[model samples]
Target: MNYMDNKISFSAYSALFNNVDNCIFTRNKVSNQVKWINKDDNDLNIKIKNEKRLKRILFNEIKSLYNNRINRYNLEGFSRINDEKIKDLEINKFFLVEDKFKGTSGQYSVFPRTFYCDKCGDLRVFSNTDEWKHFDVKNCRNKNCNGKYKQFNYVTFCPHCGQIKNIYPKCETHGTKYLKLIKNTENQKYWKVKCTKCGEFIDLYYSFCNHKDIYNLNHSISNEKSSKVMLLPVMQNSIFRSVVKTIVDVQNLEWEDNVDSIMLGSYLGKFNYLFSSNDNVNNPERILEYITTVLKTFEPHKENPQKAIDLGIIGPNLPQIVSNIENTITEIKKNYFDEEFTELTDYLILKNYFGDNKGNKKFTEYIEIHDSFKREFEKLKNILKISEITYIPDIHLISSSIGTNRGVSTLEDNYLNHFEPHWKSKDKDIFKVYSYPFETEGIIFDLNKVEVVKWLIKNKFLNGDEFNQFMDEDEAKNIIMNLDKDGEAYSHLKILLHTFSHIMIRRSSLYTGLDVDSCGELLFPKSAAFLIYSTSNINIGGFSFVFENSMIDWFQDVQLDIKDCIFDPSCLDDNGACFSCLYLPEFVCGFFNGFLDRDVFLGKTDRYCVGFWSIDIN
Candidate 1:
């Protein structure tokens, strides 16, 4: 046979090297059953397993690659070896030998699995402490990956080439700090190098603290040198930066599982109230007066379309009703208050209802007598519809303070003490025309819905005899001292009746879950509104003043119509007295939420037995 034919084929050669049984069979020096090494044969084994000798060289090459010591000298040495011999050597020793090329001298294995360049071998470590700094790759530097590189210090280096790496963009908003590895040439311990574009040292845990030296490779940088980083704007507002960072992380949280929709809706409602609306424009204070006047005009015979012509009630024939309102406003100012419509329509409403007990009827019956009043209410509704607003406040917020905060004996005491002064009257004639009420505790107590109606019918001669016992001439005189000959008592009585009617209706409705049980005006405190609006669990029994305060914004200025200098005790609920019961203002502040579908908290829709009309202040 030719020598070329005797040469082994690639497969046969690999089989002989890789298969232990085949090696024993081909060599014939050992049996497959027991080819064990022995001390006796040590010197006689000079046949030098060619595979073992070649493996020694390959091991040195791998070690050099890890130390980053591969150079011209090593490459020349590798060239002297045969390819097949080297392959056989590597395969035999692969499992037993350490992969020096995959780990740094003092670090863990970088890519213990595979060390090929195409695999992009890298070393990564993580530490809550600063000990493992060098050899830590916190993030991929590759522009596209943007992957976080773990911080595994001297534990390992880039297995591919033993190169050091870094973690970058520690905080994206600040976009200033980057993490690099630092270690002494012969030292095992490592340090982190934070090179920040903003120049200030960012602490790892307390991320915004000044600690440049800890992150600086050389602590030799002077204070002035370090101060250079201070000039940056990014460095100046650290608190803002921290907040931004916190918000970013917080935004990533799972809020969907925690907060319910009702809470979200409430939060949005408050936010919108603060930022939205132009209701206060032109004359906010007067808006409530305008609305009140429009309501009072509906009191029987209070409206005189004839007066529209008599006073010329402002130049006739305006295209829109608002224009008519404007004219009436002009007439009220020109003919009444001095030609300038300064009284906002809202305030005008209150003034007209309280300022005059007109038409010789009990004030309670005034709105019922006036046909023009109905027309004005309709007009106000149309104006509100056009404006597309949620609420036309009947009351205005003039001033407010918590009773408890005033150092009073109690909240109740504070309210009573503070509002007592408004009970005093300046002119008896003005009082007589207004029929101001006695602010006395007992009288104020009787001013509620049931008692006021009794008073109204007695003055009207409707139920005169039966209610005569409750009516005292001296009390009526005290209340009527400052009044119209026909008397302002009725006007004063109407306002108290109207507003309290709402409170009464709302209170009754709140006790019972049913909505239709109550009628007339409704006072919906926030807690009641929340209960009414909720589709889930509701607990009205536990409701109290605190709950109301927490959920609703208080109505501010309110001018109450009272019958005498004595407090209209009728305004008091069973809950005891309040300063507001002593004297009522023209406009008051109250809270409103979207009430029932057809029933708005304070919007126009006279159909529901109760409605509110939006007045045009301009």
Candidate 2:
């Protein structure tokens, strides 16, 4: 009956370490279920009202995780949740519950209360927690039997209903009251629960139920018999999969600056040729050019009649143009004054990070590393497909789990066990979604867009004319950023950058002192960049240590791993990613171990695939 202290970290609430109303596998002990109850004045609950960009995106993602019949996602404006007593409640807010716990401390109860006497083999179920705790100290409940008790290690999980409970097998003649649970050491699949009085037994591995949820879901339950219910170990790791959305603080900074810079396109009325990379619109000289031209409009007599604009004048509205340009520019510069940070502000911000202006610019958070190692980095940048390598040390990564799924890994449509704990006000109808903040070091690896377009062209996934469509780098960059996130171009770029991030994390783990599991990847697919940063909060001068000591070495050693995979053609299913090579732990990847392709870098061995290195840059 030995066990580790029942303790959990604050950060764990936002991660898989421990979740609200989920079971946790205790060391040398039966699994315990824990949950968080929302309180009005609970000081321990840190209100997560910051990181608006991350928050809105996170909310949209969580909303999408649940299969609402109406589908609240991508609905032009913010979703107005009309609560109808359907337990899902309204996802209007969030909070970070940490520190000395309030609701969940020592509140864990023994799960799968069905325990059996190893000697007598009879089942004992406990419906009362206090009585169970009192009698748990003693042995077998049978008279004159002092057999050691063993908690049933398995439970029935109703994926659709999102409920877990001990399996109760009943017989036609004699009920489950006299049931005996039996486990065969050779195979767990053969475990069974039998009626001692009738000798009739039912396999525990085969279970059933009409899976339903607290939410009034209108979706039809699966007719597929196997999917009706799942039998799994009580401590199975896949019981809960945490769904979290993260954005680097640097991305937040660039997101605001870049969005403002893009807005400059509307003011100049330069929709004909939008500026792109290098933020040409944000260039001081570029700003001056527009400013000097606009200032000329202030001249009274000098203002030419052809240029004299009025909103009422159909042909040339100089007055309206001048006012719009001035206000837009002034608003753009004021972005520097923002002090508060947020995760998500609106859903529009998720699909359109550049051109969309619905989100409030109430946050600022970054530094780019290059000048110090410009010469050394030039070579790294010269590496094939390496468009740019920005060393960002001590990055602020704000991440939070929006919800979790059971009996499945992804936030799929109609999740089986979607558990999103509501940290809402007892007095109000608001629900608080929590997030955990970590300061870590990272490196941003951006793939060359031109080369990617060329590769996509080679793969015949994109039109070849697109490469030369825009000569101005700014215009091209603008078009690229403005492209829909779910479009073909973004998907191609996302897969390439995601795969590159995985390989780099593996290589960085070997060269740097950081463990692979200690790192996390945040991908900026639109910009064709991926960041590999530390997840462990105890930052030991995180990425700088790697950047200063072993960054160059990482690039050198990457080719060695990418050259070949231990499980070659077999690993080709994922386009060349397997655990033996590019595969990474689930935590390190932000996209839930998806959108990876070694073919993006290695080129399909048997096909006409133009990988990152397929084209010649030397």
Output the number of the lDDT-best candidate: 2
Q: What are the lDDT scores of the predictions, listed in order?
A: 0.23, 0.54
Query: Where in model 1 is the C-alpha error above 4 Å?
Result: 1-327, 333-457, 460-618
lDDT of 1: 0.23
What digit string (tens of lDDT, one per residue) describes model 2 on residues 533-582? 77664666556666555566677757666767778767875456666777
| TM-score for candidate 2, residues paired by index | 0.70
**lDDT tens digits, residues 1-618, model 1?**
111122122221111112111011222111111111112122321222222222332233323322222231122111232333223221211111124342211111111111111122222223322322332233454455544443221112121111112222243444332433333243422223343444443332221212132334353212221111111111111101000000000111112221112122222121222223854423322333443344334333334544554565432332233344434434333332110111111122222222221221222233346544445433432432211101111211111110000011122321211110000122211100000000000000112222333334433523445444455534443232222322334343433333433332233334333232211122211101101111112223222221222111111111122112133333222221233432111111111111112122122223222222222222
CA deviation > 4 Å runs, candidate 2: 1-23, 37-54, 68-107, 135-138, 143-147, 157-166, 170-176, 184-190, 198-206, 212-227, 248-379, 410-431, 466-479, 573-575, 605-608
Error of 1 at 496 (Å): 5.5
